[model samples]
Target: MAKDFSDGIKLSQPRPYLTRMMLFLALVGFLLLILAPRIMDAFLANPGLNGLIVGTLFIGMLYAFRQVLQLGPEVKWVNAFRRADPGLALPPAPQLLAPMATMLGNRKGRMTLSAGSMRAMLDSIGSRLDEQREISRYMIGLLIFLGLLGTFWGLLITVSSVGDTLQSLNVEATDSASVFTSLREGLQAPLRGMGTAFSSSLFGLTGSLILGFLDLQAGQAQNRFYNELEEWLSTVTNVIDVPATAGENTTPEQASLLALAGQIAALTEQLHAEQRLVRELAENQAAIRPALEELAGSLKKRGS
Candidate 1:
């Protein structure tokens, strides 16, 4: 559904990914509420590492939500500007599209925005979005790293504990009862270490999963907004006929071929002109050579 602004503008019914993102977050919250006790115990097992992972995941979610939120307003703003009457004023555009607004505002009279100009605007907007998503991606990687770090730490502790337990085992006891008690007591250290490893892995993997889904939603919203802006720009984009400017329809290879063809045609024309000049020079020399021979014979007769 399109949102209606106070200025009487309606959206073009974009992807609605922002609403979907909110619903996804809501579902996540509900699941966490139900699993709160289990989650608490897992975190308590490896509080130092698990606590840090949760904190990182929370920050990632915050950044992802902000990305979606920022995109929503910008999408609305672009739609409003696109649909408004050309003679009237539009509501203020979002910061993402401020450069475009400035370009249009600074125009003298009868502004003609070229396709290249629109593309430059989209590039600026896309670069900013890429920067925003980079933070979320980094957080996801960090969560996995923390998980693996905890796993190795736990394994190290488990290995050393097992070795120590085996060394202290007094198998010299003559009675089975004393040997069994020593073995049981020795196993507790390794079991606690194993618990730390499993708990950290579970929490870290779960947190990353949640953050990944949120980032997916944010990416979709940004893509939709970008496409919407592109469509809107096309409406105002003018196709200029410039010999120096390459057309979008032509690839670089095609342009190079065209240049080569032109050069070949010019060379062919020059060669034809040179051939015509050479033919004229030969005809003139043949005609003058006969006249000179006749004059030389007449001079020989007069001298004799």
Candidate 2:
């Protein structure tokens, strides 16, 4: 189970800069949204077309910003997971590969390549697995937030516009043109507000649903990879415990007990040789599983 979890973690790691860039864009989008109303009021004096454009931009930016924020945390989580597994080794850049090959070839090139490839594979897998969880969670939360924000903004506009229309109607017989103008303005607010609310919510919900499905797929992949890793690791560990043959005269029971004892002894020696490797692996697995489970739960809840 531990090995399986580790493999899942490996496969989930975030992309090099994709996550970061998304996060940055999201943040900028959010900031623009925060100042959207003021900016619209000041720069866009034309309330009809300009107001619609500003509202659209604001809602779009808010949706995008929320998504980015969610992604940032996910990337951080993946990076942390990668750091926990000491056994995993990230691959060197292509430029470094040539020098590494030259140096390794001087001694045991094949052995070096084998070890390096194994390590690199583990690292890459772990990183990607970690990232998958992060992206999944971000998308879910982002969609929900975007939907709520749009709804709230829409309501505000609707209420405000309705109040203005009522107030204008209550006024003494004023200029017919001015009264009609006020009524039109009031009507426009609710109409525009409704459009923003429904459209943004629809987009946000759709995005969330799509991403949620992808997250599930990623989780399944992670689980499969983890199972394979566990099987391989178990085989390797067991190989280290293979016992030497005893004399033919030895009883089957005696041979079995001896083998068991030998295996135990080998495990102890292996643990000692690797210093804290066993303990670290155990600790890393412990830390990762709970977090992964938590993330899975969170994703499920969000999807629901």
User: What is the lDDT, from 0 to 100, of the residue 104 in candidate 1?
Assistant: 69
lDDT of each: 0.78, 0.53
RMSD of each: 8.5, 26.2
RMSD of 2: 26.2
Residue-level lDDT of model 2, residues 1-304, one tens digit each, is 1222233333233243335445555765687599777654443323443334345444544443343334344334433433444344434323212332233233321122233444555565566556647755765776667666776787788788787778767457668887777777779877777766665565456556545544554455455544544343342221222354566557789989889999999999987978788788989999899999999999999999
Give the Å error, residue 15, model 2.
19
Q: Encode model 1's per-residue lDDT on 142-214: one tens digit a residue.
A: 9888888888888888999999999999988899898899889998888778878888788788888989998
TM-score of each candidate? 0.73, 0.38
lDDT of 2 at 58: 43
**What does candidate 1 score on TM?**
0.73
List runs of model 1 lying over 4 Å from the truth.
1-15, 83-93, 107-111, 244-304
Best by lDDT: 1
